[model samples]
Target: MKTNQFLFGLKNLDRGQTMKVAIFANDDMTSNIIFAQLFNMSDIQITGLYIAASPRKGTSSIIGGAISLLRRMAFGYWLFLVFTNGAFKVYEFLTLVFRCSPQTGTFYSLRRAAQLRGVRYRKVADFSSPEIAAELQNSNVDLLIIRVGDILQPKILDIPHYGTWCVHSSLLPSFKGIAGEFHALRTKRAPIGSTVFEVTPSLDEGTPLGQVAIQRDETGSVFQHMVNNNIAAGKLLASMVLQAFQCSAPSFELYTPQSQLKSSYHSWPKPDELKVLHRQRKALITPGEAMRLMLAAFRWG
Candidate 1:
């Protein structure tokens, strides 16, 4: 609890401005990481956090922290929404360990995943509730951001002042839905990273707010690609949110999708296919001192 308090203090101070934010998040590490990083640079006043626990656990949970940051909002309120397929498993027998699978994720999982990366959560609410709409109406959110997860209802999507913005895992008009990075990997091609855009009634069909191309090496796994893309997406979203809070003109220019862009949706790989896919991705790692060095670099304290 003390750690959480300390982290929250740091988040508000980092941004150098205060924003009223509500967070809907689950998981642990990812949320903390990025929110923390953003707070380090700006001042954000987090209003509340609503986290729906992943389906693994069969119940929902909520977590909240204070947000103080770099920019000041004359009347800015923010919400970090989370959806998850609730699931929890014990890694060991008696240590109260838990594991969350992709299938068991809900909206909360999205928020949690981001928070685990060091972002602070302010508020939370489950998606199915009428209260969610009421909150959005009252929260005075200037903008809403959606990442990978359940599609928000029209009420929430349309409530924000500037409308909602979303981050698609795949390049727009290209790969959409699940398995975006996988498709790119299978095709032996590297594309731009994340596509940021304003939300419309249709998923992944929003107008492009911005698109950022990532630098990728010749040999890299779709997993790595996803990590790289997510980091970029997180930063992009943060920057936009910052600008919105300040009433500064949106940094995103109008982007219209172009032709010759192939788009497709992919389902998660099956067991047999997953095995093959894993092996293919691992093939890039190869056996070498470099692999060991990489492993040595990424460890938890």
Candidate 2:
């Protein structure tokens, strides 16, 4: 059933007539690369890019030598984004060259919708944002695709023409929540995948757009899951999102009603719960950070 839904989405793509779309994803690196790939595959142009972790004014004070080092690292990353981002935007521009159903405009104010190609960034929280709506009201957005990391409100969900969607990092209805890797480790599961679907008011419980299973392990770390899931699912979602922008989203495989009976969103395991956790020596910590994170976690015998 799952495979059939995916094939159906592809068939819809093989027949899609228009392709104007936008993307949202939390992992900056994955969003960047996936957009690059989408540029290569379709005539769809990303209107603007918004991250889940929307950047607000904040200070990171790493005094002394660490300041210069951090700045250099940031500068290098920014440079990389510039070159790559420039290329992806070029794809957007070229793709939209012969088309105009998706209105295109550039401005700096509350009277225009924020754009992926635009300098300003927004998140699901921005739907309540008067400034964003004011600026974006006149500009038409056909579809909005989310990648990961941000939870959205219904206000944002109501903005886009076809509504909002995202690609999650786990197989839905099975392992859902804050950290699925640790969840997987505790459950001793071997594989996982990304589920692209509509965003509802529940936790990872939305009807799926699509999903692709992935491989994982007992000795794995968080970053490993992050990179793997995005890479595997990123390209497919990009392609499908473009298709969805052009028409009705094809329904994919859904969780069984029995599986849907699973209840209670679980929190990340606490220090006191280690007695029930699977033990592994894989270093998920640096001596200093581990000590700091667990400072209040240990007690004297």
Write model 2 residue lDDT over 117-159, tens digit each, in one string.
Answer: 3434454334335654443444455566666544555666666
For each of the candidates, the C-alpha root-mean-square deviation to the true structure, in angstroms, is: 13.4, 12.8
Task: For each candidate, give its TM-score against the true structure.
Answer: 0.59, 0.56
Q: Looking at model 2, report the run of 10 residues with the lowest lDDT sum.
A: 102-111
Q: How close is candidate 1 to the true structure, as a TM-score?
A: 0.59
Best by TM-score: 1
lDDT of 2 at 57: 15
The sequence of per-residue lDDT tens digits that candidate 1 reaches over residues 1-73 is: 0011111222323244456544443343233222333433344544434454441122344232112210221
Candidates in order have lDDT scores of: 0.45, 0.47
